[model samples]
Target chain A: MKLTTIAFDADDTLWHNERFFTLTQDRFADLLSAYTERDHLDERLLSAEKRNIGHYGYGIKGFVLSMVETAIEVTEEKVPAHVIREILDMGRDMLRHPIELLPHARDAVVAMAKSHHRVVLVTKGDLLDQERKLSESSLRDHFDAVEIVSEKTPDIYRRIFAEHGDGSERSMMVGNSMKSDVLPAIEAGAWGVHVPFDLAWALEHAEAPEGHDRFRVLDNLGQLAELVGEIG
Target chain B: MKLTTIAFDADDTLWHNERFFTLTQDRFADLLSAYTERDHLDERLLSAEKRNIGHYGYGIKGFVLSMVETAIEVTEEKVPAHVIREILDMGRDMLRHPIELLPHARDAVVAMAKSHHRVVLVTKGDLLDQERKLSESSLRDHFDAVEIVSEKTPDIYRRIFAEHGDGSERSMMVGNSMKSDVLPAIEAGAWGVHVPFDLAWALEHAEAPEGHDRFRVLDNLGQLAELVGEIG
Candidate 1:
């Protein structure tokens, strides 16, 4: 695969993000332990998220709302006000958390940016939260363009590539999610790089598009620049 | 003027959004009353928002973050943790606030939707928040497309119009913000309808392109469909 431009996903792929969500979820489960089992609460929240994704889209705010909804449901509408408030606080804390660059994240993107590739940050989530993280990440100056989109679908990838990158033939998306960051980019005819995060949100789980010629799975972000160099 | 499609801006254009922001800002000022005067706090917050727009983008999350940033600055980093916590509560209250439809918003968009026009919602804000509001407004089925964009510019308008609505010549945008909803649409060669909201955001304030052949200023959303019919 010969790629001219590489787009990086911000959340887990860039720095610590999903792990924060997981930590929050664990706290949420503890808060609701009296009402239901931890495993049951987890299942319920995931179900609520899947059901509400169409209505609420994606982001921490939606996740919080979904958690609140789940709390009410799990307790049969008897969830305590303080519990809801705690859930909201968890979300606020997540939003306010510092951006911690994963091992070799800066070097990987910086190396690519220094190369001929037109590096772009195409992350999806709350625009403000994503932008705030991007700003704090101190990697803003490196990208040619930054797109905080609602979703990462084939249509989205196709248009982003058309406008920002060099179209699918010469574009690649490097990220953690197979459903969001990988499959869609590959479906858009761009290379998909998977660097698995230890704790991914359950809703974002999907099997990689195995047998796709342009798909690569690296265990860590440290291998990114080398992979790109080899691809070139 | 002959219009084949009409796009409406959400937020203040369709409902009572800015008023809520104003109310929240007032509370934010009260929260920081220990450090600064209300007017001074307001100014500082706006300045912070302006400076952070590139970094935080738009929507309530950014607004809350700006309020927290302003609190920290106005207090010279001596702001109480509770004060910061209050700012986040203001944001949560906003997210939970019920959707209040603006005068004649439903009639305007529904009429255009029921007609041959490919009515689209071209509002800009957090995707989850926007979708939640859209769902709550009960106007989901009206628009042929709903774009929750990061920024509205002439280029953005031109591309959206080309893809979703009729090209510039046969399209129109109806909204309250001259900068975001009207000017850019007109600059893209589409007709722009300004239905001024009482609480126009300071950042969204801009001079409408007067003497522009397709520019129309209606007193309220009530006159929208009739205006479109008359144009036809």
Candidate 2:
């Protein structure tokens, strides 16, 4: 009954955000098919991630911009104007598409809201893209607080807990990532429930921490309610 | 001909290495089909890579051991003894396989030898594995010196140049990796010819150093002799 606050990650947690970008990138690959191959386009994207890390940080917007820049550079000024417009159109689609909630995300958030727990949506991305997602999800009203951050680290979660809770162990984080969400919350001295996504990028698949006590990886979010109920 | 020294990498460079490990991993995936899925097994390997960094250093031997240990843990004591042997046998195959040179590895080494260049094989691995590779390569005769090192750093190339050459721009490096082979050599004021491999692991990809002119990334090593011939 001491559980006071619950934090959730945005991308791949409540909705299918990355799949949109992935589809957009596959289209970008098709756009460059005349000039280069899919693997080559992937290479440029990988390089762009490394290049734009400082400028744009990380997210769909940065990725979209990088793809545009790469298309021009790869074609050596021979890229047609129609193709350029198509690339921009892809970005527009990524933004305009409605947020698609995961299997149990909306239901879980609603259930938690009916309880007394303070729910927070903690996500890191471009301000506009993340805010647009919140507005579209319609579950934004369920959260008591929303944190749009540049990076997810232990300090950020600790700050949230320190300000929001009475330094209690009842605070918990539920997310699809071990690297960004689960580990940081655990390091901040809160419980972490990991909902493992079926597919992840190579960079996101690091090892779990030393012990099993602080972390729990689940196949489905439907199992989360039972875990929370048991914790109390 | 100004070229005097040539160096190389050990894993995925001299023989068919990583592909064997990948195959064995696929076999491990088959064995764990009942307990865990392929992606989960791969996730465990990624975790082991991060975990073993402090303990195992890096190489095929350590990776094999980690794979075996993960298989056992994931199977939860239900793993059969035969599966363990198959994994060990696969590792042994990689350890014992003949140094089947890449398309032009031997030709380039032989061509370099024709001009009286002091060929030095600079590889990083467990000491025994490196020595075993050199002995089996029949390449021991080609190399004037062989360094079985723990890593390839800027200091490594600096020491090699200082000890071997007359501190001239006459030394050059040829390898499949841009991270360990090309970048460090360029940093140490030596020319590097990079032959991009099909499966360049994330661990071995380096960004080009700023304002460095002594690096060239070729599609393959066959062009190495010609590239060096032009540079010299």
How displaced is residue B114 in candidate 2, in Å?
Answer: 79
Chain A TM-score values for every predicted structure, listed in order: 0.96, 0.92
Provide the fnat value for model 1, as a fraction from 0 to 1: 0.23
What's model 1's lDDT at B86?
62
lDDT tens per residue, model 2, B122-190: 876544556666677776787776765556778878888766664426788777788888888877878
Q: Per-prediction interface RMSD? A: 9.0, 24.3
The clash numbers for all candidates, in the given order, read 0, 1
Q: What is the C-alpha local distance difference test score of each model? A: 0.83, 0.71
Best by lDDT: 1
Model 2: interface root-mean-square deviation in Å: 24.3
TM-score quality measure for candidate 2: 0.48
Candidate 1, residues A84-144, lDDT tens digits: the string is 5566568778878999999999999889988879999998777667867888989999998
Q: What CA RMSD would you report for each candidate?
A: 8.6, 21.8
Candidate 1 per-residue lDDT over residues B1-232, each given as its tens digit: 4688899999988988988899998888777777799888889988988986764567876677677667767877666555555665687788778999998999888888888799989987767678789989999998888877778999988977887866888899999999998899998999999999888889999997889888999999989888888889
